[model samples]
Target: MAFIGIDLGGTNVKGILIDQSGEMLRQHYLPTQEDADGAWRDNVRDMVKYLQNYWQKPLTAIGLSAPGLPNAQNSCITFMPGRLPGLEGFEWSTYLGLPTYVLNDAHAALMAEATFGQAQHCQHALLLTLGTGVGGGILIRSELYQGLGQMAGHLGHISVQAHDDERSVAGMPGSLEYAIGNYSVARRSHGRFSSTWELVEAYRRGDPLASYVWLSSVKALAVAIASLSNALSPERVILAGGITLADDALFEPLRAFLDVYEWRPGGIQTEVVQAQFGDMAGAIGAAGFARKQHVG
Candidate 1:
């Protein structure tokens, strides 16, 4: 049997066709057009059609990894920012004409890691994705926790400091996203760099401003992780997305920061590691979810 997984981002739409054993048989990618209104749903429809034309078997189910909170029924998006404008009222399951499941992109990444990546055996885990923004998902007892109104795991919006120079639209002062997210690093360093890769390279070469920005960024991330460690008390905290790939310069400082500051009764000992699946975690997790749903 084949399952379809769609990872929709602001700039690209990535679709994957995977089999029961979590092997990707085919893949598709398309630029996210800004001029196409309601393009979010349209892009997905196109991808589905494209995959169907390439695959010999019928797709069993479709799983979507979107950027905002999925509605209670898991058919549509409820809260999304300007990047995804028409999603608030779009019915993805109906549009796709398939048994569909929609989850926040971060939540999808968390699911991906928990099912087949780094957190496979862990009962409690937290997955943090640092991209254009910082996004997070918490799993307790192997189930994704969607708090009241399906807005529970908005970890990136949490306020880390009142006087933080970086403030996000979520109204939280010094939000983790504002300080540690990819954009935050570039903005803080006053570099014209387009992406975190440039910042990481500059930091590696001992650029003073880049080093300062990188350290500050990791410090902010550590602060947030420490707080999450205390609040969730998860067995492991997995870091995914582009920024986490900054290597030891980033992870080492983060680990050291956690070692000194995490508040826990037994001396704060949560294992922190990079996500095993890297970018494919979403597609793998979506396929796993589809397989589980098909069996259940």
Candidate 2:
């Protein structure tokens, strides 16, 4: 049997076709084209149609990883704003005509980790997606807490610093999102570098200004991790998304800052690690979800 999954993001739409054994048979990608009218919905239709025609195989089930609060019925997007213009309140199943499951993209990423990556078999963990925008998911006792509003694991909104009057659209000042998210990094850099990668590279070369901005982000994340640890006591903190590609440059300082900041009841250290899977995590997790729902 084969399952199909889609990971819909602000910039791109990615999908996968996977066999029952969890091996990817084929993959697809298309620009989200948030700038183009109706492109978000159209690209998905194209990908699904193209994949089915190319493989000459009908999917057993389809799963989607989308942004923001997907309605409980798994049909409409209720609260994702500034993503795709027409995404909010859109009925996905009606548009696509498939037996579909939709979940928050962060949830899908964490589920992917829980099902087959570093977090497999772990009873409690937190996964943070550090990208152009930050996203997060929580696993407790081996279950993904989808929350009543489907917006529970929004860890990035946790405030870690005081930015005076500055705030994210979520209205949290000095939020982890406003600190470590790619947009925030670039904004705080004041155009010293056009991209976060450039800032990271400059930091790697020991540039003082770059170090200041980078360390502030590291500290803010450390503070957020500590707060989460004190409240949830998760066994591990998993870092995913594009920023983790920085590897040691990000983790080493993050760990050091976490040590200084985290307040644990027994002086225990929470293990921090990188997530497995890369660009494929969202698609893989979405298919994994469909496999569980349809096959298991």
Candidate 3:
């Protein structure tokens, strides 16, 4: 059976056609325009229609990974930001005319990793995606934990530093995102580089500013992960998204910091690894969730 997965983001919408084994049979991508009111939902419907037109067999279900709180019935977005205007309170399942399973993008990414990526065998894990901002989700015993209001896993919002600096968002002093996110690295490094890859390369070349910025980011990430480890005792912490692509420069320092700070009972170790599926994890997880809903 084939499933259609849609990953809706601020700047683009990606779709994938996958079978039961998670193989991508087809894929599509298009720009996401913030200017068009209600255009996001229309784009999704069009994308689903386009995918269905190409497949020879009937699709089992459609899964949507969106960047907001899904409605109570898991049908649509209830609280999207300005980037996705007209998404809030939109009932996507009815609009698409299909059995749909909608999930927060971060949560869907966690599901993808737990089922098919680095965290596949782990019983407890935390997935963090460090992009324009930081997003996070938690899986315990291989089940997604959607807390009350479906907003329990905002790890980036956790205060890690107690500075009186005005850079913090919404009065949350020193958020993890402020320290470890891509923009944070750029701001701290004072380099013209815009992406984490450039910063990583600079660090590799032994650039002093890049080294300082990278170390600070890794330290903040380690502190956050350690606190999470102490609280949840996850078997593994998976780092996803573009920022973590800094490769060994980021992971090595993060691992060393965790080793020093994290406390484990009986000296048990928690493995920290990058996500295997990279950007496609959300789509895969959405497909998986859609399969489950169809089966039930």
Question: TM-score of every model?
Answer: 0.89, 0.90, 0.91
Which residue pairs in candidate 3 have backbone atoms (N, alpha carbon, C) closer than 3 angstroms, thus clashing? Answer: none
The global C-alpha lDDT for each of the candidates, from Candidate 1 onward, is 0.79, 0.84, 0.80
Overall local distance difference test of candidate 2: 0.84
Ranking by lDDT: 2, 3, 1
Ten contiguous residues minimizing lDDT sum, candidate 1: 185-194
* Candidate 1 residue 128 C-alpha distance from true site, Å: 0.9
lDDT winner among the candidates? 2
- Give the runs in model 2 whose Cα sits over 4 Å from its true position: 54-58, 264-267
Which portions of model 3 show Cα errors greater than 4 Å? 164-170, 190-195
At residue 17, give the lDDT of candidate 1. Answer: 87
Q: What TM-score does candidate 1 get on C-alpha atoms?
A: 0.89
Worst window of 10 by summed lDDT in candidate 3: 162-171
lDDT of 1 by residue, 238-261 (tens): 888888777887888888887778
Query: For model 1, what is the alpha-carbon lDDT of residue 289?
Result: 67
| Candidate 2, position 203, lDDT | 95
